[model samples]
Target: MSFDDDPGRGGGDPADDRFSTLGGTRQTRTRLPESTGDPYGSTRRPQRGSRSLVMVVGVVVLLVAAIAFANRGSDSGSSPDGQSPKKPDAQSTAASGTKPVGGKQGGIASGYAHDEQGAQSAASNYAVVLGSEGMFKSSTRADIVRATHDPAVVDGLLSRLDQAYTPSFFKNVGLNDDGSTPSGLTFVSRTVPVGTKVAQQDGASATVEAWCTGLVGLAGPGSTKPVTQTWFTITEKLKWVGGDWKITSSSQTQGPTPVSGDDRASTADEIAKAVQGYGGFTYAR
Candidate 1:
């Protein structure tokens, strides 16, 4: 997950270092300790039993109704322009309220505005393209580099990437000398952004971190590098150029990963089929 090496081809640091610490979800149920006997059992004191019961029931009903009404109000709070209200997590982890740029360059999403939010959106989607299987191919790699990096740095970055994805490297990842998979195998390399955060912001410059989960390796019978998932985060330093956010420099590091799940791992054929059937998404914010 660094510029110097290619984890997409299984040639880099050990995955133990690339895992994130933020993907686990667990639920717990709690119950109050049960009482062995009623408080008034030994005292035998007369209580306002009927009246207290009625009062408690009425209070509980009022409380429940109040909570329901409050939640409804929270959910229905919309913009004056008839747009949906942004979620509470939007500012912290969810997609921004701003819409994604409605354009593409060399098949990669582009036209990000000159702002911190836009920079974050651009970095996220760009990360997706850069970490994909397309990077292994010469034509698509050139297009991705051109689309994501600033014009002045495009040539240099592309040259460095070209060396990184050498034929030997491709062979190590179960691809041929030209980065093509064998007839029966499917090469998979896809990066999925989980969240984005702006680390710094200025009028014309910004640094954003895109937390991502990726799938890499080959899938099929007798495949040496069976597809596996990894978690990592990419930081992109961007500048406002050509009326959009473009990468000046970028680096990736091990993740803020979570614990592995309990689901059974699918076979290679199952993985290949699933990958082919499911299309990827366009990330923003």
Candidate 2:
């Protein structure tokens, strides 16, 4: 569910595997390393600006866009491999032409329509907010919980996550004990949704899975947990409560991950600069 700064966890947060293929033999033909692992056995050392993160995010983005573009006047898009219809009618790849939300509640998107499209939108945006660096802080995390979760569950959820995002957790991710970024460094924890799928849905309840790639850790010179990317999927069970879709329960797993790429890694300065320069989008279907 959660990953730690320690690379030993084998979670593959980032750059965890460069310099692995220094020397190796090929049989009859040259074969690329397995998309999953480094040359150094099973563990991968995090590489700054790891190509895996960039490539995964890029591929997912392109795949989503291409599918949407291909499905443009149709009722719905096919699954990634074109094996099956992603959903029934009313399911779509384009916007619903209705406003995504009526307004913001505690700075989080709110008032999504009581429909499958609305559920997807709600899940996408919630994934971004929940995975943001802000969630590491107590005050901001509380606000996020109140804004996105069902009222009945807010208190309980906060109590649980408070224990989870403890000082030790913050420290592991390169944050100060108070969850603040150290001076001269930037903390990055952002989730960009690659796509959303409605796994199950009904009139008042739904389960949406957000396939996402995220950036975490610190970005600066000589940083220990240098900014790295991670691939993970967030599954949220939501209810159309009080005129809006709100999270009732949510959990994360490692990934519906793609194979690693062979692109050269960027420098820490480049990664930090890119994070600052590029503004994240308000994701939707």
Candidate 3:
């Protein structure tokens, strides 16, 4: 995360949607009151104030070029929706040696605990898990559902979700239920948090909304599910549980996204090949 010249702080890294309506007897649900948080809230994230003084038009153009360049990559490289990766973060690092370290657990995110940034980081990371490929895999889904979400929603949400993941869904992701091999396809399901903000914060709790983009697709021969992009916001109502931020409840909604550019969409096979051939990084704050 070098801040030498780029703004967006030396602005970031990337990857990459939805919300639900409420129903009666469904328990108390708090809809995320529509607030965009602070899109330009770099005041808290800055280590020095010197950079803020310069807002060169050429620099803004440079930043835009940088963003576009950073986002250009394969499906395996970014948020499922193919957005740019999270730029270098000042707070999180591979050296931080955070949770579930390297294994089946390698995908587990860490570094959040008591700090306000930590709270927002946890919510942002958890939001990614809440919307990943694991959600469609029965066993993996169970593990993630338990680790990231409220316990009450685990069972019912799982049941309802199971119904939603039809053969059509699996076919789209190049997966076959029973968690077996789905021929030559590489299944792609991932969520990338573009940016996170502390909508409201206090010592014991925080509300962090992770703006994200995602992909749910099949990456093999003869598959119809095109790897498409989606934009959504995930508002996590977090509680400082056991010294770590845990999601008490979370909800989603559609885009606060910008218009798409004319970048050439990659082919299903090219996307699938990329997914299978590549791996993911452990996202940090």
Best by TM-score: 1
The true-versus-predicted C-alpha distance at residue 205 of model 2, in Å, is: 1.0
lDDT (10s digit) by residue, model 1, range 173-245: 8899989888899999999998888899999899999999999999999999999899999999998888888
Weakest ten-residue segment in model 2 by summed lDDT: 21-30
Of the pair 1 and 3, which is ahead by lDDT? 1
Candidate lDDT scores, in order, read: 0.81, 0.81, 0.65
Q: lDDT tens string, model 2, 10-88?
A: 5552245442221121112223444454466654343333356568889999999999877775745456677766455
Winning candidate number (lDDT): 1
List the candidate 1 regions with Cα displacement exceeding 4 Å. Answer: 1-90
- Give every collision pair in model 2: 15-45, 15-46, 15-47, 16-44, 16-45, 16-46, 17-44, 17-45
Residue 153 in model 1: lDDT: 97
The runs of at least 3 residues in candidate 2 whose Cα sits more than 4 Å from the true structure, single-residue gaps closed, are 1-98
Better of 1 and 3 by TM-score: 1
Backbone N/Cα/C clashes per model:
6, 8, 21
lDDT of 3 by residue, 1-285 (tens): 233442232235211001211121122223343445768643433232333324455689899998888767423566767885787775432333434222223356643657666776687668777777777778787788667655656688678778887887665455675544467766677788887777888877788888889887766678766667889998888877655666777789998888999999888778977777876654545
Per-prediction TM-score, please?
Answer: 0.70, 0.67, 0.57
